[model samples]
Target: MMPDLPEQKGFLEQEANQFFEESFSGFLIADEKNRIIRSNKRVSAWLGISPEEIKSKKISDILSIGSKIYFETHLSPLLKMQGYFEEILVELNGAAGKRLKILINAKESASKEDGLKLIYYTLVEASDRVQFEQNLQHGKSRAEKELEAERENVILREQLIAVLGHDLRNPLGAISMTVGLLERSIKDERQKKLLQILKRSSYRMNELIGNVMDFARTRLGEGIVISPREIDLKPVLEHVVEELKFLFPDRKITVDIALPEPIHCDADRIAQLASNLLANALTHGNPQSPVSFTASNETNKLELSVANDGEPIPESLQAILFTPFKREGNRPSKNGLGLGLYIADQIAKAHGANLSFTSNEEETRFIFAMEC
Candidate 1:
C-alpha cells in the first residue's frame, strides 16, 4: 500500500505459492480472453511444457478434439452464465501427443477488477480410475459368458445321462426277471447261489442307474413339478424317513417331526427336498451314528433340517459344498456322483426357499426354509 506493505504482502504470496506447489491437482490462471496468465508446476508437467512457455498461450491449444468440442458447446456457455463449472471430465493432449483424462473444475477469480474476468482451473487426472472401471466391466462380462457356457454344458450332459439310464433300465429289468426264473428252475445249491449273486449285481446296477438319472434330472431343471396346493409337510417327512429306512437298511436313522400341526408347502418338491437331504446324510454319515431329520414351523416360515454325525466337512470344502460335483474328504465306500446337496439346493431355491448349513467336528446340519 502507500504505507510500507512489502513484508506482509510477500508473506501472503509465499503462502499462496506453497499451497499451489503442494497440491496434486493441476492449477491454471487465465485472463478474460482465455489467455493463460500463470500456471502451477503440475499443469506444466501435465502438458509437458515450461510454466513460462504456457503463460501467454490459449487454453484450447492443449485440449483434445473431443474435449475442445465439449468445452466450446457446454463448459464455455455454463461458465459464462454461472461463473463456474465443476468436475467436468475432459481429455488433454500433451506436447508429444500424450493423452490424459482429467476432471476439470473452473471458477472466476474475485480479485480481478479491470473489467476482465480471471478464471482459475483445477485438473485431476482420471486415466487410472477409468482404466480400472473398464477392467472390472471386462471381467464381469467374461464371467457371465463362462457361466452361460457351463449351464449349456450341464444341460447337454444331463440329457445324455438320462437317456443312458433309461436304456439301461429296460435291459436290467429283463435280466432280473430272467434271474428270478432261473433261481426257481436250478436244482444245485451252488447254481442257485450264483443266480442269487447275479440278481444282487443286477439290483446294484439298477440302483446306480437310478441315482444317475435322478441326479441328471435335477441338474437339468426337470426333476419336480410343483403344484402350489395346500399340502401338509408332516406326512411327507414321515414317508421320506420310511423310504430312506428301506433304502439304507443297515444304517440307524432317527426322524423327529415337531411342527404346530399342518404346514402348507409344495408337497412333491418339499418331499424331494427331504428325500435328497436324508439320502445325503445316509450316504455320507457314519453307519454306526444316527442321522436326524427335523421339521418345525416358525413365524411365517417352515423350517426343516437334516443332520448327521459324520467326519466334519473340511474348512476348504465348506465354501463350495453346494456346487455340483464338489466332493471332499475320503470318498465314502458307497459310490456317488456328488449331486445330492446340489439338487437339494436347486429344489429349495425353485420353491422360494434357501438351503444353508452348519458343521463342526461332531455334527453337520443342512437346513432349508420357505414361507409358510
Candidate 2:
C-alpha cells in the first residue's frame, strides 16, 4: 500500500491546498507591517469585495470604526506580545452599511528566519450570539427601571394617606362638638334615639380615623411610638370595657381584673389595644353570647385576654390575621378598614410583648402577655 516518496509529498501538498480553499471561516495572511499578503475567497464574499482588491490592504481597512481603534490600541499590541489571540469579538464593515459580527483568531508564524514575519487570521461569524447577548442586557435594564418606579409610587401613596387622615381630624372634631350641644336640648323619645345613633356613628368614625393615621405612620416606617412607665393597667382595661358597653348597649361584655401591682407600659396605648379588641369582638361575635375579658398579673407576668362565642376563623385567614387591611371576607359586617387587630399587634410588639390568638367552634380568644 506504500507509495513512492516523491508521490507521497505531492499528495500531501495537494490535500493542504484543498483544505485552505474550502474552509468555512475567512482566512488571511499578513506581514509584520500589517498589509494583507493573501486573502481567501470567503473573505471576499463576506466583505463584498473581490480577492484581488482585498489583497495588499491593511487588516484594519475592513473593520468597523470602533473595532479599528480597538485593534490598533489594544488587540494588535496584545497579539504581538503573546504571539497569538483567539475568540476576540469585533465587527467588520460590510456592504450597504451592514455590520458583520465575528469572532477572530490570529497567530504569528513560528518561522522568523531572515527578518521575515507573517500572521495568519481566522474569522468566524457570530451574529446570532451577539444579538442574543444584546437582548438579555436590554431586558435586565427594563426590569430594574420598572422596580424603581414602583417603589417611588408606593412611598407617594403612603404620604398622601397620612396627609388626608390628618386634615379630616379638625372637621371631625367640630361635628362631635355640635352633636354634644344638640344632645343637651333634645327631649323627644324618638329624637333622643336618633341622636344616640348619630353619637355612635361619630364615635366609630373617630376610631377609624385614628387607625388610618396609625396605619400610614407604620407603613411609612415611623412605627408605633410609645412611652412606657409603671401604671395600673386594671383601670385602663376597665375604662375601655365601659366605653364599648356604652357604644353597644344591647350587647353584654363581662370583665375580670386582678392586678395587684402596677405594670410598666404605655397606658393610653394599652387602652387603645383593649378597645380595638373589644370592638372587634362586639362586631363579629355571636349576638346572643357575652364577650369575656380578663386581665391578671401573676409572678410579675401580665396577661390579658378577650374571648367570645363565634364561628371559627377560617384557616386561610388566620395566617394573615395581623396583616393590615385584611379581614374575614365572608362576615356580614365589612364596615371597618380591618386595621384594628393589626394596630393592636403592633402596639404589643412595640412594648416587647406577644399578642396571639386561638379560634375554634366553641370560642375565639386573643391573649396579650408581657413581663412586668
Q: Largest lDDT belongs to which candidate?
A: 2
lDDT of 1 by residue, 1-372 (tens): 386589989999999898897679888888876788888888888899898899888777779998888888888889888999998888898758889899899998775466667999898989998899899999999999999999899788889999999999998999989998897889999997788678757855765676577678776767644567776678778887886785576887777787765765677767877887887888778788999888888787888999999788878888998887777656554455666677678778777789999989889899998887
Give the per-residue Cα lDDT of candidate 2 at 155: 83
TM-score of 1: 0.60
> TM-score for every candidate vs. truth?
0.60, 0.83
Q: Give the lowest summed-lDDT range of ten residues in model 2.
A: 16-25
Tens digit per residue, CA lDDT, model 2, 99-192: 9999999999886878798999999989988889999999999999999999889889988888998998899899889889989999998998
